[model samples]
Target: MTAHRFRSLLGGLALACAAALPAAAQNFPDRPIRLIVPFGPGGGTDLIARIVAERAGAALGQQMVVENRPGGGATVGIVALVQSRPDGYTLAVCPPICATAQSLYNPPPFNAERDLAPVTSPAELPLVLVVPRSLNVTDARGLLAAARVRQGGLSFASPGAGSSGHLAAEVFHRASGTQMVHVPYRSGAAALTDIVAGRVDFYFDTVASALAQIRAGEVVALGVTGTARVPQLPDVPTMGEAGVQGFDFPSPRLRVVAPAGTPAAILARLNAAFTTALADPALQARIQDAGGKAAGGTAEETRAELNEEAGRFGRLIREIGITAE
Candidate 1:
């Protein structure tokens, strides 16, 4: 064939492929989908991912497999998600860790905003300020007073250097004008154990993780991190309400994201499936029981929330000088 004829043929083929893209998306998830949870099994993110996937898979007519890839402050798995093909098969469950990864890492492997496309947020949970029953604090003001007197003598525990709990504590110190020694741990359970043993003075832990302890009277919940009190702990006042102004730490939002450049049609389908799953009455109750509320909305809403959280936490991380160890 002549050179001109060959060029024309290539153009025709490109148009044909472009035309078929939407049809391909329409037949999406012909196979199982992999949902990566960037934390170890049994953690809040992993548990929430499993619950949502079990129901979303039914909506999508395919199996949604939960894959744990825990490392690098939850960025290892997110980096993997970023590198995956944007065909809508590989997705990830992103929590507050994702929002802070870029801020905490010296040079993050992937930018959550640039590399991942938000699908939807499945749930959100507030962190609660909990202290050992042995401590004498009962509210935010009392905790701040205690910290002020002790200065760096009092210590706060977190799952790790950049986890939500860690940043929340940092923000609390910044807003309350009190300083406390930061104690980083390998896991939330470990941190909670120390707090229960009175090894640590306080910890900002998720309601889910600290609920049992709070109910058992092992730890005292000083305040919740949300703008409003959490239903699970209705009597617990918000940090702002408890006397700490501008003390709202962004709640941990569980978002679903895919590799950037995924076809818009495919993203829409995935969003619909997940949102429908979140709307199920059984799923909402289960989420509430787990100390969170179901949150399902458009991809744009998720994107906005993630961006807002990243900006808010990034400023706090910089102000606190928190670096990944």
Candidate 2:
């Protein structure tokens, strides 16, 4: 074909594809949608995923199957997600780890900004700084004092390396000028169990994972990592309120994301379905009961939030020299 003729043909194909997008989106999700949970079952991310998946699936008139693919600092599943077809059929539940992975790894695995597209963050759960009851540290100051006086310093546990809890504790350590040994566990539940048994000195765990233990007095609440206190722990103080100066960490958010280059129309549909699911009073109540607040907004807002978080955590990880290991 002549040059001009070939150029005309390409333009026509582009126009045709553009015209077909809306129709494809209108009939989007005709089959079941796969939602990848980047953690083991029963953890905070998994819990929120199941709660939102059921309602979102119902809204989309399809089943949102939850698939657990936990490993590699929660990046294994996300890498799989990034490599999948960007047809809106597969999605993933993104935690703070999603934003931290690139910065935490050498050479990086997948760039979150380049590989994933945000749909909406369904919920935000703050981390609670807790200590074993055996320690008798009632507040942040007490914990600091204990850490300073202790022979080997205190030990802190996280669900895994590069997790929000791990980074939060690192931030806390720097802000408070205290030293704490890092203990990485397979899951938050395992870390919490060690805390209760006095095997671990302290942990910065999501309120969702630690609420039951906190309520049962198995562990003592020091302060939350957010600017505001959690309703579930009404009497507990925020890190700033508890005397860790200017210590406010964005609560770990649970987000819905698709592989990059997914159709914008399809993303809009997914966002709407999740927004509708999050608006349900029953779902909100369930989220609150699980120690998270329901979050819903436009896809742009979700993207902006994730980007800002990635920047913040990226700077922190670089400064502290954190690695996935």
Candidate 3:
């Protein structure tokens, strides 16, 4: 064929494929969708993912399969998500790890902002500041006073150096004008164990993880890290309300995301399905039961929130000089 003819043929094919893109998106999820949970099964993220998957799948007329790909500080699943084809078949329940992974890793394996597209946030978890029952501190003010007197002798336990709990404690320290030694552990459960044993001074743990302990009198709830009091712990004062001004730490948000470059139509469909699931009164109640608030918003809102959180945690992680193991 002549060169001009060949070029014209290529252009025709390109136009045909572009026309088919929306048609394909309209019939998205002809099969089961893979939903990656970056954390191990049974954790709050996984539980929430399962709940949303069940509801969203029904709404989408497909099954949303929950696949646990836990590792690398929740990066393993995210990397898988980023590498997946941007056809909306593969999505992930992006946790706070998405915001902290870049700062935690010396060189991040995946750039969350560049590699992933936010769909919608399904829920937000509030962190509670708890101390061992043996501690004499009654409120956040007393805790700050004790820290001041201890003069770096006081220590706080966290799941790891760059975990949400760790960063929350750092934010609290900056707000309270106090210092505390950081005690890192392999897992939140391990950190909580030490806190209950009085080996660690305090912990800013998720309300889900620490609620049982607090109810059982194993740990004393000093304050919560949220703008307002959590319903489950209504009596617990917020970090700001407890006297730590400008002390709203980042919460563990449950967001859905797809690979970057995914068609806008596909993304919109996915967001609508998930948001509809999130809006279900039963789903909201289930999320509340699981120690999170059902939060569904536009993809743009989710993206903006993620960007803000990434910046906030990045600064705190750098200031604290925390490096992942």
Candidate 4:
């Protein structure tokens, strides 16, 4: 072939490849995207899920429907997600430790860390340390002092084994050097029952649940788990402010992920949509109003946060001698 003809053909081929690039990036979400939430409705996780689904769906020009598959401390929905097609249409709204559930919770056949790849973090909400109002404990220090007087016999309740509440309680336990008996329950309602009845000594719960109970005089939030006191629970001090030094928040954070082997392009696309949508005033206000702190970051941040929480929790559990039961 002539040199001129060959050069012309190469230029035309390059132009054709450039034209297809847009299709490759934009072909996503030709239909609805199913958002799998690993918890029941109305809790902090549910609220975040709905916010992301609604906002991202609007941004992506597709529908993002949230599906609750709550069971086994979010393991059930995750397992279902792992088994889903990795076409970017099926994504999961997972808590930070959804990746570490394998190490923290009872043996599920699959390793979540190996099975999932992060898309983005929608928001994070720190739970509060609280006790039944009848317990007359108004602060973590007071509770610790009372537990110290009780000699490690004060009982506490958590939603389930290895849940964020359970792990955060461990963090509180380590920081306060207090040993309180854990009373495990299938759900927060069940745990709250015993707590309000004064059968359990203390517990930490997400704002969506704990704040309501705190205002009703059913439980008293000793303090918030974050660095600053939440606006809704303004009267309550932070965990550190409540006299537990070095004890930061035990966060109830949500991250999005897909089954491993999903393409990086898809992850990047999803992350862009999430990052953009989360910054919108309506979305941010809705999330904050629902007792969550929206966070937008790269996929690496989500992965690192999950890993850090797992490592932190694993040590706390072992140090506290928390055995899986």
Model 3, span 235-271: residue lDDT tens: 9988878888878675678889999999999999999
User: Best candidate, lDDT-wise?
Assistant: 2
TM-score of each: 0.95, 0.96, 0.94, 0.88
Better model by TM-score: candidate 1 vs candidate 2: 2
Which residue pairs does candidate 2 place in steric collision?
none
Clashes of each: 0, 0, 0, 1
For candidate 1, what is the lDDT?
0.88
Model 1: per-residue Cα lDDT over 198-278, one tens digit each:
999999998877888999999999888878888899999888778888776767888999999998999999999998899
- TM-score of the candidate numbered 1? 0.95
| Candidate 1 worst ten-residue window by lDDT | 145-154
Ranking by lDDT: 2, 1, 3, 4
Candidate with maximal TM-score: 2
Clashing pairs in 4: 225-249
State each model's CA lDDT, in order.
0.88, 0.90, 0.87, 0.79
lDDT (C-alpha) at residue 304 in model 4: 87
lDDT of 1 at 44: 67
Candidate 3, clashing residue pairs? none
Ranking by TM-score: 2, 1, 3, 4
Candidate 4 per-residue C-alpha lDDT over 1-325 given as tens digits, one digit per residue, 9 for 90 to 100: 9999999999999999778756766898689999998888877778778887888888889989999998866777888889998878899988744745656655643575688898888887878877877777767777878878886567878987777778777677767776667788888778877888888888788886666677788878887876777777778888888888777655667889998877777788899999889989888888777777888789998888888777776676666666545
Write down the worst ten-residue block by lDDT for model 3.
243-252
RMSD in Å for model 4? 4.8
